[model samples]
Target: MSNDVKPGRAAAIKSALESAFIALLASGVCLWFLISETQASDDGDPAKLTMLAIGLSAGLCAHFVYMAIAAKRAERNATLWVILMVVLMPFTSVVLGILLFNQVQEIEQQAREEGGAGSAA
Candidate 1:
C-alpha cells in the first residue's frame, strides 16, 4: 500500500478527527454528569455507575483515535514514535505529532520531486 494519503483517505482522516473530538466532548459531559450524580446521592446509584462507564470508555476511544491519526502521519520509525507517544502523553505527544507531520510532508515532497526528475529523464 502507498504511504501517501489520497484525497479520499484524507477525508476519512478528517472524519476520524471530527469523531474523536465529539467523543472527547461526550466524555467530558459524562464526567460532569457523573460528578454531579455522585455528589447528590448518598449511596451508589446505577445511573452514576453508567455515567462513569461511559466517561471512561469514551475517553479511551478518543485517545486511541488520536494515536492512530498521529501514527499515520509518522513515516520513519512509526512504531517507535507511537510507543514514545503513549509513554509521554499530553504535552510531549502533541509536540511529537507536529514533528511527525512535518517529516511526512518532507518525505512526500521529496518523493514527488524524484518522480518528476525520473519522468523528465
Candidate 2:
C-alpha cells in the first residue's frame, strides 16, 4: 500500500519497458521497409537491408531473453513464455512484455504486503 517502489521492481519495470520499446521500434522499421519501394536486389542496398534485418532479430531476441528471465524470477513458467514469444515475435513481443511486467508488479506487491504484515505482528 506504500507509494514507495523498491529498486529491484523499478529496474525490472524499466527493463521491460525498454525491451518492449526496442521490439516495437524494430517492428516498425521492418514494416516500413516492406511497404517502401526499395528492392533489396535492385537499386536498393542489400547491405542496409541485411543490417536492418539483423537489428530486428537482435531486438526480438533481447525481448525474449528478458521475458524468460522475468518469468523465472516471478516464479512463472519460463519455458512456456519463451516458446510463445519465439513463435509470435515482432508482432506479439510488446503485448507479452506488458503481460509479464504486470505479473511481476503483482507478485512484488503481494510479497510487500506479506512482509509488512509479518513485520507488524
Candidate 3:
C-alpha cells in the first residue's frame, strides 16, 4: 500500500524498449548487408537467402527474449513465454507479449489505487 512507485517498473519499460531497438537495428543492418551484397544472380541463390532469413529470425527471436524478460519481471511466466515463442515463433509470442503488457499495466494501476486508498484512510 505504499505510495512510492516500484523502481523496477520504469526500468523494465526502458529495458524492453532498448532491447526492441537493438533488435530492430540488428535486423536493419542485416537487410542492408543483403541489399549491398546482392548480385543479380544471387537472387536465385538459396543459401544466401537462407542466411539472410536466419539473421532476420535471430533478430526477431532476440526481441521476443527481451519482451519475455520484461514480462517476467512483471510476474508473468518467463519460461512458458520463452518456450512458446520458440515453439510457435513470432505470432504466438507477439500475442502473448501484448497480453502480458496489458496485464502489467493493470497490475500497476491496481497498486497505485491501493496505495492511494490506503494513504487517504
lDDT tens digits by residue: candidate 1, 38-61: 788788699767868777676856
Q: Score every model by TM-score.
A: 0.52, 0.61, 0.58
Give the per-residue lDDT of model 3 (tens digit) for 1-121: 2334574674675568468658857977877766766755545567877798789878877877786777666666778877777788657656765775665566578777878999999
Q: Where is the poorest 10-residue window by lDDT in model 3?
A: 1-10
Query: Which pairs clash in model 2?
Result: none
Model 1 poorest 10 in a row by lDDT:
5-14
Best by TM-score: 2
**In candidate 2, what are the lDDT values of residues 17-50, reduced to their tens digit?**
6665666577667757744626544566777767
Better of 2 and 3 by lDDT: 3
Candidate number achieving the greatest lDDT relative to the actual structure: 3
Write down the TM-score for model 3.
0.58
How many angstroms is residue 82 displaced in model 2 relative to the true structure, after the best TM-score fit?
Answer: 1.2
Name the runs in model 2 displaced over 4 angstroms: 1-10, 30-42, 90-95, 107-121
Superposed on all Cα atoms, the candidates' RMSDs to the truth, in angstroms, are 5.4, 5.4, 5.1
User: Between the candidate structures 1 and 3, which one is better when assessed by TM-score?
Assistant: 3
